[model samples]
Target: MTKPDPIPARLAALKTTPTPELKKQWRELFETEPPSFNRRYLESRLAYRIQELAYGGLKPETVKRLEALGEQLDGGNITLRRIRADRDRPIVGTRLIREWQGVQHVVTVTAGGFEWQGRPYQSLSAVARQITGTRWNGWTFFGLKNHRRSA
Candidate 1:
């Protein structure tokens, strides 16, 4: 004679059962109102609850350690990230393309700085000035800044 695999069998049955039936089962199993979760969520949680009843839940020491770690991390104020110039720049090996005065300008992103016309340059504005013969914000020239370019 083989023993019935109750947990898995119940989980499988829970999948096909309707919401009301699952709710009734929940009431019988837990003697409480079922949460308004979806069918799959209900089944999975119910399956876990059934297994927990049959076996056991998290160890007391594990729960205590987790709670202690949570308390340690729960600082009252939210930490703000500082804005950095390096963070504002693109990652290395990225290529940025722009068209000005019916001409296409290409700039390669590098660890040192932006590269243009087979030469390494320190800034995008410098590259833009070289291309346009006028002073311009490197970020604005490259459309990386929050300003709209004039048509």
Candidate 2:
């Protein structure tokens, strides 16, 4: 039987590798200056690179499909850094519309917060409260999240 790959052990060792050595590995793997993140970042990225090379990275068709999807998601402006930046936050320039009491309201996501009818609010919940005149979880009201269970 084929022996198990030794890459996993090496990846684990990366957690304890010296910062300088990790930087060297990073350079060899990516052929660029390592980002100025932290030791854990270096180790994780290096590990992924090692495994990707030993095995194979994503298929060409998969890459193309993902690129097409990214373009559709972000109008062809998607990048790794951009996706990471927007991962935890809503995509800027996206519009959210909700109807309350026969009136439809639109909110646009901004860098700082969400804009509702020409006013900026820090959170969707705030806008929901303003619109409903009652406490609410904005995501649920916006249909972005499931309704909260009543206890």
Candidate 3:
């Protein structure tokens, strides 16, 4: 007879397992401290880890291809990579709209850069400069900056 499948049971247990126990399991499986993210993040990552261990992770070539795509998006700039990694970076094909002095401006996000007023710019700051005739922080001018709450 074939051996029973343990993967299903393992994945199911993650749903009911206590957060501390999940962290312990994460330590054992990932060999690192668990991130300070919420319980749902832990559960999902633990489930993926269990499945990855049981089956396998992505192939090396696939990983390489993904990395290459990421590099193309960030153009190998460390600062750009950090910004691109941010959740606030607008996705490709997003349209950012802003009105300056009662004149409406629209910018389209592209795979390589941004387009505004029939011109392509490498950075949103350049588009903002063109709109306002002054230098501006793209994220702030575009209202993408993360706002922190005070206690």
lDDT tens digits, residues 26-89, model 1? 8877889987655776787788888888888878999988888765654322331112456667
Candidate 3 runs further than 4 Å off: 79-151
lDDT by residue (tens digit), candidate 2, 1-151: 9998798889889988899999999889999998876677788889889999999999999999998987766666547545544465557998989999999999999998799989999888999988987667788788876432321
lDDT (0 to 1) per candidate: 0.79, 0.82, 0.84
Query: What's the candidate order when arranged by decreasing TM-score?
Result: 3, 2, 1
1 or 3, which is superior by lDDT?
3
For every candidate, C-alpha RMSD to the true structure in Å: 18.0, 12.9, 13.5
Worst 10 residues of 2 by lDDT: 142-151
Number of backbone clashes in candidate 2: 0
RMSD of 1: 18.0
TM per candidate: 0.45, 0.48, 0.53
Using lDDT, give the best candidate's number.
3
| 1-151: candidate 3 lDDT, tens digit per residue | 9999999999998999999999999999999999866788899999999999999999999999999987787767888755644445577989999989999999999877899988899888989888887667887788866652211
Error at 74, model 2, angstroms: 3.1
Q: After the best TM-score superposition of candidate 3, give how far the Cα of residue 4 lies from its true spot, in angstroms.
A: 2.4
